[model samples]
Target: MRSEALQNWLNQFTSRSEILKNIRDLEKNNEELFEELLREGLTYEEVKSRYTDFSYYKGLKIPEGARALRAVEVYVGIMDFSDPSVMRLPGWHDGNTPSANLIDTSALFGALSKRIERPFLANKTIYSRSNCLIRYTGEALYQLDWDVLHALICFCRGQFNKRFEVRQIDILKMIGLSKAGYNYDLLKDSIVRLRKTDIYIESSSKSPAMSFSIGEVKSLPKGKRRRIDTFSLILEATILDNNVLALTLDARLKFLFGNNEYGLIDWEKRNKLKNNDIAKKIQCLISGQKTNMQRHRMEKLYQLMGLTSSFKEFTRLLKHACEVLLAAGVIKAYAIPAAPRGAGQDRIITIWTTEIPTPEELQAVGRVAAYACGE
Candidate 1:
């Protein structure tokens, strides 16, 4: 009988503060029952069992600051918030100096490749290199999608499963897009596409297959309705309002960064090469390698770039891209060896040791190395 009454009272309140206030009121009338309920119903074990993780805390009256900390705890499993490495990362901030952009090795291998004319819902194998196979479903993604995703990741500071807010104009500026009306529309489309795109990765290594999306957008509720006659006004107001976009990255992304399986691309150089998709893709591919010198077959490069041009044209484009990279100091030198007699494939070899690191880059590398060593 008492349990039934307690559940009825609990269901009447939606927020935590309301529940606490009612509980205090109950204590005033029934001290013995209140103490018993506090011990049995609100114990630490019961609370922990009910709210096992951050996701379970949503829609509750938890403070946003506390939510952020709890999100880190749930995803990272680090109890000590005092650790500097848990809150900060190299190349994650935007400043005067160039910072590194974090990208998963699987993505850097051309998962988000050239643009497709039509969006497809069925699973399609977009990129396959060596033992890595990447399949994607949903809207077609291109260089712009890649740029938007990178900027969003920077905004989140590499924290997955945490909500962050940003203005559309700020996103545009971060991606080197001008603040025009059409650009805002383009940004909105890109965000939607990112939310819809699903990626599945398969590798020949011992690790199992992984699947995830880039991020999800949060929708704001409409304002209260005034009257039927004022419907148009309300609609117009909603359309004209400049609302901040809220986004949460997937927690599974942390798996990609684990075991030093991620790569850091020079952010400034990427922005410079933004107009040239081929050059940016090549830059990512080269940056993902462990050694300074790398070689790839021309046939494989053609497929990896998702280019529809003829082999001859692709080789021409590849040469030009290398020249652009050389001018930008992204690569030391590149050579495309001609196919020998009756050879099935030619190779494009590149060396990137000539590029000098900025002070920020060195500091970032030092921090990563220290963290890896568990310092």
Candidate 2:
């Protein structure tokens, strides 16, 4: 198949004369007879001189970082920090996507529920914390599940309607997929979680209960090859189209992205670092928060980031993240506050705006969390 890059090259020289000339000059000496080349008047030249002739080049030929893929354009944008502002999407749930698998006990949300072992809370199945009530239902989604959701959210943001078309290659690229390559089974299970896991939100107002996804999948085997003569001529092989993957976003999600309640992430940077679990989770937690200034206990934070590690171990991972976040100024500094009485007893992490935080500000609520929590 012709890469999007190569197909673009073919489009540059629309004239047959230019195509034939480029082909012969670069064809590496094996120019055999063909009705097409004969029709175009080309010869089998075994040797060529390193001669230079000035030719007026056409417009930009998709240089290496043509980072202008359609989804990329929608999800990412260049920022002008002089007047700092972020892209906001309305009705974005901004849920605390705590990791299920990170803590061994957390995944118990599904298995424990199956055994009905609880003195059930709110709605016989609800879990509550300060000011929030969650009527949990179905198997809890893990970090991997959140991965799929985040990808879809990235796709759905700025889109008007709920429906969108995707190519398999596109999803792979967006997720910053590793060379280990696509895991078809994992993808199938993720779709099921999005479809089957149901939860009802009852914070500010009442709304409909919905399940994200439920295991149903239809395979779209690769489609028939596109018939582009110029493309075929370049590779001397057939080229196939990417398979289309169609999905519907939950209407609730429309509140997140469609309405402009989205967070701006430096995708270039995030994409580069996402393979590291600590790095990936921290970036999202920092950006996903609705408020500009957030202070959370290290323990709460560990839960929020979905880390199952002990205080000592999780902080080790978190310390690594602080290096990146601090250098980028995403976080001001960690403060293990000697708060009034018993407020925020655990180590506290105070986050700052995109701008660098002042030293005095860092010192005020400030005691190093590492020392407080035992580095």
Candidate 3:
């Protein structure tokens, strides 16, 4: 009787165990299928490598001018930063400048957030780099327009250096969004998850209103870094971006030379950069370093071994290299002038091109004229 009872219990457990096993197998299959769809056209390494770089993304596929909730939230953040109250502070620019009466976050938001009566309401304390956090209200969730958000981000970054990173949990309380005791941890969690899977979150410091290039700053005669006192940081940003993009174009265009018809083939793949001392010093100049040497001697070396020919090629490479650096956000665009002569014509030389530069290119030409003149 005891043996029969034990057999009946074992039979029941076996059936349940088989059902559990099936459930686990089904879950595994679903996961694999979902991953397959996600990686349909991407290679494993391509998909894996994207996450290595950091960026600022507004939301899922928020195309230009498309409306979305997160987009609106981001826009509001920009508006909050640009309010006259924030901008008009006497010492705001100095950061150490003090104000007799500082505006609190709630009052500032109350003043700014009115859509009709007051459209620029803000909520957190508006002091220093402490941000005016706009809580992600669920009410306007569907209508969060993204174009507005992008414009706002661009405006804020350009105007005030304000940038949005991953949302913080304490931000909800700071912005007065936790009144209902809602678990905003869930909201934070969702955004965090999106960041992990999406490739768009990476962001750069906002581009400047105008373009500039890496040539703005140059090394002086005595191994010292000279500041381009004339070029503003904002101008540098724009130049940097353009240089990078142009460089990418140049690099891709270089492949055209590979045609046997063009006679661009290299017999020795000439390593113009040898281990020679002079060569290494030249490398330093290209890499933004300074060294002391007699200009006459340097000029002599340029002619002695036909280094100028090499320099001509190097200049072409330098232009392309600058573009690459700008693309990588390493430097900005700057117009360098040609050497000057007493009682001689002071002509402008577009450093990266052979053609005469446009009027816009001439705006900052005077700054580098002396340096290029070798005076």
Task: Output the number of the lDDT-best candidate.
Answer: 1
Superposed model 3: Cα runs more than 4 Å off: 1-310, 338-364, 367-375
Worst 10-residue lDDT window, candidate 1: 228-237
Steric clash count of candidate 3: 29
Q: Hey, what RMSD does candidate 2 come out at?
A: 20.5
| Candidate structures ordered by TM-score, highest first | 1, 2, 3
TM-score against truth, every candidate: 0.58, 0.48, 0.15
How far out, in Å, is residue 183 in model 1? 2.1
Tell me the whole-model lDDT of each prediction, alpha carbons only.
Answer: 0.51, 0.40, 0.24
Query: What's the count of clashing pairs in each model shown?
Result: 0, 19, 29
The global Cα lDDT (0 to 1) of model 2 is 0.40
In lDDT terms, how accurate is model 3? 0.24
lDDT of 3 by residue, 1-375 (tens): 012332342245344345333433333454432222222111122322232222235654533222222222222223221121122221122111111111111111111111233122122112211322121111111101111121222223223222233233333322223434344543333233222221101111121101112112335778764423221111111112221210001111111111110111111111222113232222222222121211212232232222224444433433443344333322233243444454112333233211234456556455542222111
lDDT of 1: 0.51
Q: TM-score: which candidate is best? A: 1
Query: How high a TM-score does candidate 1 get?
Result: 0.58
Task: List the pairs of residues colliding in candidate 1.
Answer: none
Worst 10 residues of 2 by lDDT: 43-52
